[model samples]
Target: MQTILIIEDEKDLAELVAFNLEREGFRVMTAHDGLTGLDQASRIKPDLVILDLMLPGLLGTEVCKTMKRNEKTAAIPVLMLTAKGEEIDKVVGFEVGAEDYVVKPFSTRELILRVRALLRRAATPPSPGSVVKVGPLTLDVERHSVAIDGAEVSFTSTEFKLLHILVQRQGRLQSREVLLRDVWGYAFVEDSRTVDTHITRLRGKMGAAGELIRTVRGFGYKIEL
Candidate 1:
């Protein structure tokens, strides 16, 4: 069973989410604050995280940043929660490493659908069958291993799919939603932050090889080749 870690400061909301997720046959874990949430995430290494932006002790953005930086937890998908819908805040969430974003007062049905999409995307298998290399980066699709200059680079499953998509697309600009759908396979996931988080983690793992991924302003991301 897939497990989800829900990190929210509101006790009532947290319990409600946990209950719903359990009903859906998912193993659920929850935290009420950012610091505790972060610690639990590292320990459990959940399949996905439902994070609240206004968390106590540490901001959700800070927690996301730390998780994305750590090799062990970086690739875990995060769906950030927030009451504010400011464009800037959403952008910041994306920049800090959130896979998706959810506004407050959201519908429980929508929330459940989004969660299922992310989990499905995370579990989807790659189509690439052989090792594909572009410059110094080598992606062994079948084995799910990545290498830079022949040295192995550790990657989470989501990160691998994200990289494979970029490598296949090469110079074509891919919007965040497009990546989420093609790489993550979630058509209704409105939050592009999911793409940002996975991309950041992918780049960090690739080191110099990551430079192959380029940002397209007012559009999306691509591999320059």
Candidate 2:
């Protein structure tokens, strides 16, 4: 069973979420503060983390940043739960390494669906023995690793998948909607800005090779050789 850690300060809400997730057959763990959540995540290394945006002691963003910086727990996906639904807020959450986000006053059904989706994506194994080369970037699809100019670089699963799709398609301009569907496994995304955010992050991590991922301005993005 996949273990999920819920880091929420609101005890009642956290228990409610834990109850539902446990019913879904997942092993659930809860933390009422960001610091505790961070520590628990490091110790337990759950498959996924349900992080509340606002927490006492440490903010959710800080906790996520720290987790991503740590080698032990960095690969675990994070799904941010927040009351703030602004575009910028979601952008910031993604920037901090959240794989997905759910706004406040969300329905239990939607929350469960999002959690399942994230886990599904995480469980997907990369196709073996396939490698794609774009400029100096080498993507070994089998190993789920990327290297730029022979130097290995770390990427979130979301970032890795996004890069894989773009490079696989090569030179094709993929609209945000298409990327959202293909890369994020979302049929309909509320805010396609999520694509842009991941693209930006992908580019940043690619360093000088990032220039190969060109912005198509009014459309979306494309990988140019």
Candidate 3:
């Protein structure tokens, strides 16, 4: 039973989400304000957090930043909820460490699917002895660990999957549509630019090792030493 924390200011909305998730066999917890939600997240350390962008005491971005900065709760995946559909808003959410974003006025079905996808991504480990090395970076697939120049680097589940796919097929061009389908489990190629946003964040996290990931003009990205 995976525990999920819902941080939404609207009581009715939170309850509705909690009810649906519970029906799907998830243990749900709710917090109506940002501060309370953040505190609850730190205390409970749920497997996943469904956080609204706007909150009473703190913004969802801030909560995400704090959670990502904290060692204990940083690995927990966050699915951001936002009323805004602007590409910039979604990018910001991802930049702040959100694993995925959900626009408001969303169907319950879509939201639930995204939640399940994120959990699946988080729980699945790499295959045995499938370690990958590019330049000074080393990815121990079996351990789900990435080290750059002998220093371990932290990546969100989404980022890790994206990197793993790229490195596994180093020098092979991967179209944005393919990456979305394979890494994000998107059935259709919607929001293809999201692949770009995540790539940018992944590169930033990788520091100098980021250069190993190359962009193919008008196509997608790849990794090559």
Candidate 4:
């Protein structure tokens, strides 16, 4: 059984999630506060983590950073849950090494699908063809690193994949729905703003290379010369 650590503070919601996950044949571990969550994460080394942004004692972003930085827990995938309009922290979460994001009031079905998908991707071997480059940015899909002008710019897996898709199709616009299906590996069910949040962080990290990624009004993003 693949163990999943759910770091959420809400008692009712946490238990509900645990019940559903256990029913789905997953081994569930719950942590009600951030400090405990971090401690459990290091010791348990779960296959994945469902992290809530608003946690007492440490907050989700910090947890992600701490886990991803530590050798013991660095490979564990994290999916962040955030309230709408907290796009800023969502970006921060991704920057800190989260693999995916789900907005608050999200369907349990969609959340579970995302969790399973992330774990699947984590288990899958990297394809040799996954790497991409555009302008000054080089995305090492295998290593999950982005470098600008030969300088390695740190990026989480999701950010690297998102940019890879954009750079692979430079000079063409992609709708938010398409990006979700492509980089996120999910269909049209997710909130489109998830793309925007990731784009903001991806651009911020890319710096001048970010100029290559342009937003189309009322549509989505594109990588252009």
Per-candidate Cα lDDT values, in order, are 0.83, 0.89, 0.89, 0.84
Per-residue lDDT tens digits for candidate 3, residues 69-174, read 9998998999998798798898789878898888888899989988988888778766667777888999988787899999999887678888989988888999
TM-score of 1: 0.67
lDDT (tens digit, per residue) of candidate 2 on 67-153: 999999988989999998887888788887899988898989888887887888888877667878888999998888999999999
Candidate 1 local lDDT, 64-166, one digit each (tens)? 9999999899879899888978877876776676767789989888788888877777676568499888999888889888889999986655567788888
Clashing pairs in 1: 98-193, 99-193, 99-194, 100-194
Which candidate, 1 or 4, has the higher TM-score? 4
Flag the better candidate by lDDT, 1 or 2: 2
Which sections of candidate 4 miss by over 4 Å? 82-85, 129-132
lDDT of 4 by residue, 1-225 (tens): 999999999978889989999999999999999999999999999999999988999999899999988989988999987674476666677778998888788888988888888888788765575667777877776676778999998767777678877877889899999998877667654478888888888778888888888888898889988
Residue 201 CA error for candidate 3 (Å)?
A: 2.0
**Top of the candidates by TM-score:** 4
Q: Deviation in angstroms for 72 in model 3?
A: 2.7
Count clashing residue pairs in model 2: 0
Report how far off residue 144 is in candidate 4 (Å): 3.1
Runs of candidate 2 with Cα error greater than 4 angstroms are 149-152, 215-219
Q: What is the alpha-carbon lDDT of model 1 when measured against the actual structure?
A: 0.83
